[model samples]
Target: MVKQERAVRTRQALVRAAAELFAAHGYARASLPAISARAGVSTGALHFHFPDKDALAGEVERVAARTVRELAGRCGRSEGSALGALVTATRQLAVTLAADPVTSAGFRLGGDPARRHRAGPLDWWQAWVRETVGRAEAAGELADGVCSEGAVVAVVAATAGFETLGSRDRDWLSRERMDRFWTLLLPCLASRPPTKEPRP
Candidate 1:
């Protein structure tokens, strides 16, 4: 039991370390030795857990996807309007990307040209926006004449732009910036704008 638990901890440590390195240096540039050293684990342990750097990156992507899916699920379960939920989810995602190295790295890995077969974090987000916007449209949360595709494109594009810009300047992902984005956009997309002051 102790051995299994230690193994789990070691794996978690490796993933966290890899995420930090991958975030700092792109996937192609991040070395296994550096990751293992950062994790305080031997290179042998890293190889035992992951066959290669791609595999390690793949695990990070999986963890990131799960985190994002959970966030989206929580938003979906909200009792408020679908449009409200979508806005909330977008804010939450931006915050996560800014705060969590793993998530940020996962997005980078997903977009990496070398990983042709792997779906990136952006793809997952785009799909979520499509579904969430579709729900809002069906629920009559969208403004009259607002096309679902248009709404999806707008939201996804803005959020993605934030994510890309945040890579250079984290201020791009700030709550104030995101609030400004929603403030400008919600009225155009939603049938009725939120009455409550927007959360940061």
Candidate 2:
């Protein structure tokens, strides 16, 4: 039990250190010694915790995925329509991507196909968008012919494209823009509300 606990603590420290270094320097530029030093661990400790750089990279993605998924859940409970939920979620993610170095760097690393072991955090987010959009359309909140799959593709592409843009000097995709996207999407999905019956 003691060994397990110590191991867990070591792993957590490594992840935190890696996140900071990777965020600051980008993944390709970060080295095991640097990460170990940042975590206050020996190089052997890093190797013990993570068999290779790929393993560490996978762990980073998992951490990022957990963070983003939590963010997505918060979006769902937020005040708004289903479309509103999606917009809120995405906008929050965008701002975080722009503001947080760890998040931004993790995603950049996840972009590499050879390195990724998980569902690709970006892909997961896109799948969420597609599912949410499909549900909203089915519920009569969006315009007809909205094309849930295509919309997912677009949202995924746009989000990544924005990420690749490195969050510098961009005016688009503000909360307002997200709202606008929703507004344009709604009319086609939602049918008119049924008229109320006459009072007796």
Candidate 3:
């Protein structure tokens, strides 16, 4: 049991170290040796946990996806309406990207030209946004004449842009900025603009 626990801790450390490097430097530049060094593990230990860089990146992406899904799920369950949940989720995602290196790396990896074929974190986030927007429309939470498709596109694009920009300046992911974005947008998207802004 102790051995298994140690192995799990080692793998977690390796993933975290890789995520930090991947977020700072794109996939093409983050080296295995550096990742192992950051984790305070030998190259041989890293190889035992992950055979190659791709495998390590894949694990990072998987962890990021899980984190996003949990965020979405919590927002969905806790909010009074779909539109409200969508707003909350978007705000939380920006905060998550800024605070969590693994998630930030996963998003960056998705857009990295080096990993062109991989589905990255944005794909999953886009899908969730689309689904949530659809639900809002179905429930009459959207304003009259507001098209769900257009709303989905706008939300996804804006949130993804924030993530990309946040990579360089974390202020882009600030709560005040996100609230400003929603302040401009929510009035148009929601049937009744929420009286109280969603807290991060």
Candidate 4:
């Protein structure tokens, strides 16, 4: 049991270290040696846990996808309205991107030209946003003439942009900036005002 626990901790550390480097320097620039150094593990240990940089990046993406799913599920269950939940989720996502290196790295990896094509964090987020927006439409939360597909595109594009920019300047993911975005968007997107105002 102790051995298993230690192995798990080692894997976690390596993943975190790789994520930090990937987030800071992109996939092409982050090296396995640097990742191992950051994790305080030997190269042999890192190889024992992950065969290569691609494997390590895959694990980071998986962990990041799980984190996004949990965040979306939590916000969906807690909010009174679907649109309200979406607003809350977007705000939380920005905060998450700013605070969590794994998630931020996953987003960057998804868009990185150097990385091979895969359904990375952005893909997962886009799907979630689409589903949530569809639910809001079904719930009659969307304004008249507003189509679900268009809303999905808009939300996904905006959030993806924020994630990309947030990589350079965290202020792009700030609560105040997110609130401002929603304030301008909500009036046109919603049938009625959100039940809860944006959190201060």
Each prediction's number of clashing residue pairs: 1, 8, 0, 0
Residue 165 displacement (Å), model 4: 1.1
- On the 0 to 100 scale, the lDDT of residue 7 in model 3 is 98
Alpha-carbon runs more than 4 Å astray in model 4: 198-200
lDDT string, candidate 1, 125-174, tens digits: 88999988898888778899999999899988887788779988999999
* Positional deviation of residue 81's Cα in model 2 after best superposition, in angstroms: 2.0
Tens-digit lDDT string for candidate 2 (37-61): 9888899999998998778877877
- 54-95 per-residue lDDT for model 4 (tens digits): 999999999999999999889888888889888988999999
Query: Per-candidate TM vs. native?
Result: 0.93, 0.74, 0.96, 0.96
Q: Which one wins by TM-score: 2 or 4?
A: 4
**lDDT for residue 143 in candidate 2, whole number 0-100:** 60
Residue 135, candidate 3: alpha-carbon lDDT: 89
How well does model 2 score by local distance difference test?
Answer: 0.70
Local distance difference test scores for all models: 0.85, 0.70, 0.90, 0.90
